[model samples]
Target: MNTDSKKINTSRISISELMLPSHSNFSGKIHGGYILSLMDKIAFACASKYSGRYCVTASVDTVDFLSPIEVGELVTLKACVNYVGRSSMVVGIRVISQNIQTGKIKHSNSSYFTMVAKDDDGNTVAVPRPILTTLDEVRRFYDSLRRIKAKKEHMEDTNSFDHTSREALDRLSDYGAILTL
Candidate 1:
């Protein structure tokens, strides 16, 4: 067990920007890629703050665009370090857009980014453990642990799966198409 622990609140980061036309798609709504860029930026900041070292994104999970953001709205991205392992931290990001005139806000996106701490030579480095200060923070840590377990199970299943097994072929038969072989 690591003796060092850092408060979750110390790793939180938030940034808000006005959605401009240049950030939108042809349909007059903010582009998903643009939102993802902001998410990555905030995730990096949050993880770096928590780890006290340079961090790089290992994987991006659960990027769900809940609603479309209008071009003239104010978009905000909030990120926090939800979980930490020896060298990795899970950064949870929530994105919301508010209509400045009407004051109506909508949840536009939520995502999780796994970042790994790195040293000056680009080698992985260990990060301090998170000190969960509140119930909500504890719950977030549990959720991240669950997600990590599920991901490992999924990878194990995928690695051992036989895609062309009789059972798999039979399942594909539900498409109402005949198999060539």
Candidate 2:
């Protein structure tokens, strides 16, 4: 148990104050887009390091803004490589807004991003990703896995119809059907 605890602590990566612009917004609050941009950059870095290849955002499951981040606050973005697929990786990212003066911190946003590893040709490639080395890492890994699994299942439930008007037109063309009178 002691060994496992040590591993979990090492997996936690906290990045601080990459961006907290006081002049960026009129209300002195960091824009939602700004936070997202920072998260994307950090998440991309984490995924790219794990995959050892170029990675692109496949999807951002959810990015809920719980509170506003004021200017001059230290916005800390924490991320970890949670899971990996054949050519895909998922990263868990959290943004904590900390007031520099008062030292009050609040979770401003939390999100998971799916990234696809790509080769030099921009084609998807398989790469080694992070493994759950400790209990905390395992827990986060499972959570991300569950989220992806749920998303996949939910996607499957949607209509799989691939019918397109262009294909319909091609099919009708064989009948000499220019019946647009």
Candidate 3:
């Protein structure tokens, strides 16, 4: 890790007691939606702290279940704000399960959640977030930013397919080249 990055705070919060119905499913594993809801809560908390405002989950790219948490076990969800962009933040969440009796802890799932901050009028708002606290974290955060930039560029390129002189003229006919919804 870079020395400067190592000095930064990478604070995280943990939530215990994620409940699941014992009779919910086969193999008695916690339902994925149940886990997702827990993740959303943790992610929101992380983002709210990072943004210092209310935040909502905008998307969940992927979630993988590596193991199962049986009923009566204590499920712990740890979440951290891993990256940020204008008006958006990405949170990393890891779910671990502990057997209530034996106290054995095992990894259960991992997910990345994207959240967006909003103002009173429901407009998206930007906020400062934590600085990277490790070389790995810095690299990952920058890589995610690159991906976001590339995605935006890709969208612009796609839209260019329909961009033409005549189309531009037609756009002006509407309102000086402004797109009206």
User: Which model scores highest in TM-score?
Assistant: 1
What lDDT would each prediction earn against the true structure?
A: 0.93, 0.75, 0.76
TM-score of 1: 0.95
Error of 3 at 111 (Å): 0.8
Q: What would the per-residue lDDT of candidate 3 be over residues 1-181, giving only the tens digit for each residue? A: 4332222144378899945675247667777777887889999988887677789888886688898678888988988777777888878789999998898999998887889989888889976745665787787677667756776798788987665567665767676556563
Worst 10 residues of 2 by lDDT: 2-11
| Per-model TM values vs. the true structure | 0.95, 0.76, 0.71
Candidate RMSDs in Å, in order, are: 1.8, 8.2, 9.7
List the pairs of residues colliding in candidate 1.
none
Clashes (backbone N, CA, C under 3 Å), per candidate, total 0, 0, 0
What tens digits encode model 2's per-residue C-alpha lDDT throughout 1-181? 4321122223346678734464357776778887888888987887777666788999998888899887777888888777777888778888897777787889898998898989999999976634455687778878877887899888886656343556766677688877452
**Candidate with better TM-score, 1 vs 3:** 1
Model 1, C-alpha of 117: deviation from truth (Å): 0.5
lDDT winner among the candidates? 1
